[model samples]
Target: MSSPRLWLVGCGNMGGAMLRQWVASGVVAPDRIDIVNRGDRDFPGGVRQARDLPDGDLPDMVMLAMKPQQIDDIAARYGERLAGVPVLISILAGVEEAALAKRFRTGAIVRAMPNLPVGIGKGVVGLYSESADAAARDQVAALMTPLGLVEWIDDDALFNVLTAVAGSGPAFLYRFIDALAAAGATLGLPADQAERLAVATVQGSALLAAAADVSPAILADRVASPGGSTREGLNILDREDALKTLLVETIRASVRRNAEMAAAARQSAVGLGRITLFPFVLSLSHRPSSPRTGTRRTALRQAQGERQGGSSSRNRTKRLSWCRNGANSDCLEGAAMVPLYP
Candidate 1:
């Protein structure tokens, strides 16, 4: 099937990675993808990037790849324009479907949790959608196919657990790799060589585990002789299921945090006014003292236009000067807002 036209909001680290893979794999043509980001990025040829949403009709799908905290801000800026999009896919961690639905109108709201490795087509993408029909689900699955293993989560809570596990799994594994290398170095091996060996060992072992029919436990046992160094090492990790216990606690902590973030996202409506000032406030931080004749002034004017619906002489002169001096709580008057950086 042909790929759907995709409009991406906030092409940061994870989003940029997915874009690179999609373009390279020919799953989605670069020309068919539109990205709205805070600034320019070196994306594939034919892909368009701009500070604001493109003009004209919406695409078949819209994916939110920005920071989870910016959800309200994005909705405020583009919610009307995005009304009735076929599918709205969000990769923001901890934000739920209901939160998205409350902010914007869409046919289906899908929450996708993807790890960093999706850039290499080896990541796992966990999808969950309560309102989408089978056809919509299938369409989403097909689009995510080139990214990696795509699994549809049955329950919302389970989806959160999956995010804690798969989405955060890569970082935990990196720690283990680093520890393994450090252990080798402690045993007097050259540090650089130890790291190289440790990395390769992990890479080869993961590939083998994936291909093996037997479980990882069986593979470990198969490697360890009745009386050997491997067996001795296994005994330590196996004592009282220490490794498993540690990992369970780690993931449990992550799950709790995800829930907290979800709650915050749901209640973020109260902060929409403050969130709307983010882009303009961010621009102020990098701008020169004199915002006389640059994009900085243009951005300020744009923010004023967005907030107050056109800039007046008084707004352009007095308020603009006040903001250029530096954005503070007083700039907006009675609105407890600060610059994006502060």
Candidate 2:
């Protein structure tokens, strides 16, 4: 009669949004979440928050929602405990399923990339998992269903592209809104009023496009009157496929950076002789009580120490990161021999 237990680590923006949706839609009960975050951000009412890991035992599943940069801290502190978890889902960008599996030995590991819209039910979520069974994948999908449209990629390499489109796409849309509003202001409307009108137009148009059976290109024809203003605007956007061209590069840049981070995470994972020791020298004793500095720093110092102290250990920590992002959920396994990124 009870919802399955789920432990969430690092519920800031994306994680926090998932928690909000899960509880609001009644897909998961509030009591099921045991959130371990650094500082208190907002969470759905009645969801649990803790300064540290729960004492008794691990939950059946762990959904890691921290930024990709925070993966090292997670792996250092929680990797050993994660060995037996049935499923592990990561929403961090640039991090890969293999890297996650190496860090946390879950029976199945999934990398999930979701955009900010997930706070509302209209968001988009992309999933990549090497789960051995259908049941395991289904279990993960059911939880994400309430948040928004759920998509799984066969090529993990495409995740970088998905991240740009879905994950960073919202920001891009917001920017376009700002551009439209600014252009409207140039025509003498007050900036505040222009902003409101621009946002409303985009929202309504999006809804209209969604409901219409015809493609957006066809819908545009219905809007453009003979020699009318809408046609003029469409001509400008259509010239050189301006919007399409800009978006191609926009996604390309995002995917390129994701690859860079992946390389950094991988380089650190292996205990290669290249690892260097950078010990943490805090002036006073850094205890775990102050979850902010204490817990995180403790984990980082430990990961760094272990990396520096190893010979072959330096290069043995393998990692998974998004390749040039696209629709492909393609994964690059057996990257052991792949040259480490600088």
**Which candidate number would show the highest TM-score if scored against the true structure?**
1
Model 1 regions lying over 4 Å from their true place? 270-342
**C-alpha RMSD in Å of predicted model 2 compared with the true structure:** 11.9
Residue-by-residue lDDT tens digits, candidate 1, 1-342: 676799999998899988898888898989899999989999999999998988888898899998887887899999999999999999988777988999989999999998888899988899999988998898888888788899999977666678878998999899999999999999999999999999999999999999999999999999999899999999999998989777766665455445435544555474333343434433343332221223223333434343453323333344446555653212332112422210
Worst 10 residues of 2 by lDDT: 319-328
Choose the strongest candidate by lDDT.
1
Task: Go through the candidates in order and give the C-alpha RMSD of each one to the true structure.
Answer: 13.5, 11.9
Candidate 1 — what's its lDDT? 0.75
Candidate 1, which ten residues in sequence have the lowest lDDT sum? Answer: 333-342
lDDT of 2 by residue, 1-342 (tens): 357689988888678888888898888899878988888877777888987767666676799887665677778887786678888888877676766766777788888888777889889999887664798788888888888889998876677667767888898899999999999999999999999999999999999998999999998999998799999999999898888766665655456445534544555653221222212111122221211223223223333443454443332222111111211112122122223311
What's the true lDDT of residue 247 in model 2? Answer: 69
Clashing pairs counted in every model: 0, 22
* Candidate 2 Cα misplacement greater than 4 A, ranges: 270-342
